[model samples]
Target: MTYLKSAYKNAGIHHKMILLIIVLMLVNFAVFAVILKYIFHIYDNQMYKKTSEVLNISSIGIENELRNIEKTTFKVTTDEQLQRYLLQLESETSPYTKMVLRKKITNRLIAFAGSETYVYSMVVIDKEGQVMSAGNREGIPQELHSTLSELADEYDGSNAWYAAGHSSLVAARQFKSFTDSNFTLNGLGTLAIRVRIDRIVADRVQTSGRDGQLTITDGKRMIYPETPLLSESDMQAELARKQPYGIATYSGGTFFAAQVKSSYTGWTYLHMTSFDDMFRHITIIKEIVSTIFVIMLLIALALGTRLSGSITKPIVQLIQNMRKIEKGDLDRLEEEALGPVPFSTQDEVGLLHRTYKKMIRRIRELINENVAKQLLLRETELKALQAQINPHFLYNTLESVNWLAKANKQDRISEMVEALAFLLRSAVSFEEQLIPLRKELDIVRSYVTIQKTRFDERLIFQLDVPEELMDAQIPKLTLQPLVENAIHYALEPQIEPCRISIVARVREGSLFLRVEDDGPGIAEGFLEKLHSGQVTTRGQGIGLANIQERLHLIFGAPWGMELHSESGTGTSIHVCIPYVKGDQGHVQGAVG
Candidate 1:
């Protein structure tokens, strides 16, 4: 096993692929051969079975017609008028009465003959040798009388068919008086119904071979196929053997034959065929298929070298390049290391090389980019540290100014400076804690005092907040931004003083703070953008939207801000928050 493996490993890829193709071809042909043989046998068996079935069906149909003929003969004999006329014509010597009786019998024969398409001729021969006939009068010859009378001789009130000359199917039935008490042989007559055998088997034959023959035989003579495929002696020999049905010999092996017995008539149906002629196209098809297989195999061999080299050479180069990298020889990538070569076809190997080249280029770009990203990261860290120092410095300066104002005894300046210091302190600690509403109001008042110093009498504000909500806690700076906005947009740009009302109301276990300004109302477009948070205003330190988001973040999302304004009227901003005071979650649920 080791030696075989070594030899296979040493073999060229071209030889390996050719070997694989040869193995596949052999397996495919082996399976096709078995299926082909099976299909051939099935074709022959089905053809013979189909031929026998068709012939059997035709024979039954012909027997049914003959039975109808016999039944019609019995019906004619029972017609009392026709029977009386026949008997009267035989004995009456009056010429006028004889003419009338003959016309009546002829009319009766016409009725039976016209009833069925199978009836070629209907003839009735009385015991007195008088004859009456209807339908296809030209069909019966003068010699048909003697020939058909012999068939009627042995009949015991049933039908007997004969292979009459001129391809006639003759059924003879003996008619006797059903009502006469003295019914004897002399009183009986023959009713002969002649039909064309060619018409009986007209559309019945189904055979693939053009010269194939299907015939009905009465164990005495062939009854169909006016031109028989077998000679008279050969047909006689085949019939005499009485092989109920199945394979019979024909001209050498070129012809095939099978027989089936009719259930309606005790007749044998024979089918003869030339199988070689029928299956000659199959041989031609086999030859064509063999030619195509050989041609494809030759083409495969011709293209084997190029196809195998195209697949294996690129993969082998990629593997060698990988091995060099694995051994840490990546720095020695030079002319000695194989480069990618263009393929003559778009195959998997070509795709692999294309991807490998792209990967090598992308990896080099990524390494260079990663180094630049690390340097930018250090620069960003320095900027972040510088950003932290400025806020601390501003807070320190505010404290120093507050202390200096107090020591100098500038009472009003000291008050303003201390409020500034307290607001700055709250702002610094705002993110870390929640404050009481009173602390928020102090910040708003201090900010309002500072704003009033700039716009003396133009901003008149009132606080109508209830004492119950004064202790309720909320996010710091929630209401201050809204009040600052009312002072800025509503009072800052007006000559007349505008009144600002701050009211706190509790309803449905929730606290609602309303800030109203009776100044020129917000513009229609700006109000829409403000409500939708599409515009921002820095009236105080943050816009109304910022306080809204803060209230939502501190409480749940359901607590937020609401705004209502008219064009010429005033504006109102409502702050809706969960009512939480010192130790209470909500007003009614307050624990303290």
Candidate 2:
């Protein structure tokens, strides 16, 4: 075992994988074979149970049918009217009286035979040569006297049943004198009822699944079927076994044989099912499964070889690249043969190759990073100086304009100047990305005031923010862009007055600020174009998409802008943010 382990450890990965796969397939196939055997065992058990139940039920049915036949024979033999008529017919010598007596007995026999579907015929024989019969047969049966003699001697006064032919049976009972009860034992005549055994077997005997032959015996000979499928001696021998039911062998063929003995008639009902016939499909399935297992083993071997090679080839290439790097041949690593496409297989080997390449590039980038950093610092300083100068100059100019308008008694001009100053300050401030709700709304109100002066009654702006939530912190410029979008898409297109409302509410630990307009809604597919930055705006202003990105950067997921609108149903934009009270400190790094 130690030597084998050492050999396996020394083997290449491809060969190792192939060996492991073969071993696994062998183990799996062994388990499958065991499971198949267990399944077959269960199937055999089920078949046995079903066959036993059918045999028992069939035997009971046949027994009941035979009992009914016995009752009919008993009723006919002890019938007082029939007994008196038979005796009178035996002693009377007048032709007309004899004919009348025989007719009456024949009518009684016909009635008895008609009452049972399985009964074929009925006959009565007095002590003399006279015969009275009914149904199917017009005259007496062959050797009726001898048959009755045998039955009378064997059964005494009880009913006796014996096979009449291949498909029929005869039941015999001694008709006795009913006038004198003490002399009832004296045989006045013989009454025989012929039964259709085929009908009885058809109605009562049931075969289970598959092909099987049914044979019944009177503990003497085969009766129902004209001929036996098995040799008579073999069947009798199987019946003679101590076991009531089991598998037996006859003439080198296997059979499942079960027998039930009738309690009333003492007949044996044997069902012999050929083993080959019952399990022919099972045998075919075994062959098919074995063939499939062999085929799968072959396929697995082939696939294992290919898969092992595929897994190791990428690793081999990576190792070769490492060897080149060891020899200081880094230039050759970037050639067409070692390009990114060659190592882009989306596996660990590919990732390692890519990481190695990135490390090489990072080393070169670090060598020049110091110089690039110095230049970037100078450029940023110059831009910051310009940003400070321009915003300060703009605010100072707006203040001067407000003073000039107030001196001229131009109230509208002063109001527009103040609103413009406020809007400019809010847009230029880069110190905080989040501000109080009241401050953001103040900026929005200033912007709306300026727009209201321009549109007058055509722009009906309504604000419904609750006073309690005015101090909640939110992302700056959140509502300004949404209000601007409503004006552009909702108000500017129509001549009628558009009612634009901003409503704020607190829900589920968050604050929702909705901006709605009672104007024609934006067209379908326009929102998608807007989000994709395809819908170009007229001036230098932030779009709704910018607000969405800001919210995502500050609050991560699920807190962002949602828009709902339909044609002629107006438009509403909801800005969702976490409701944080008081100063939450300045959010860092996202102001720009």
Number of the top lDDT candidate: 2
| Stretches of model 2 off by over 4 angstroms after superposition | 1-22, 93-100, 137-145, 181-184, 208-211, 242-244, 249-254, 274-277, 280-288, 311-592
Q: Model 2 reaches what TM-score against the true structure?
A: 0.49
lDDT of 2: 0.80
Candidate 1 C-alpha lDDT tens digits along 342-375: 7664777777877776676666578679889989
Please list the C-alpha lDDT of all candidates, in the order they appear: 0.73, 0.80
- How do the residues 1-592 of candidate 2 rate in per-residue lDDT, one tens digit apiece? 9999999999999999889888898889889989999999898878887777788898888778888889988898888888788777767989899899889998988887777887778888777756788887433356765776568557876888877556557888888676673355677788878877777777887773357877788867667677666787897788788776778889848998877787767888888899888889999999998899889888988998888777788678767766776787745546632454454477766677777777767755774696698899999999998879988888999999999999999999999999999888888887986788899888889888899988999999999988999888888888877788888888999999999999999887778899999889877799777766577443337777777888888987667888888889899988887777655554432222
RMSD of each: 17.5, 21.2
Give RMSD (Å) of candidate 1 vs. truth.
17.5
Q: What is the lDDT of candidate 1?
A: 0.73
Colliding pairs, model 1: none
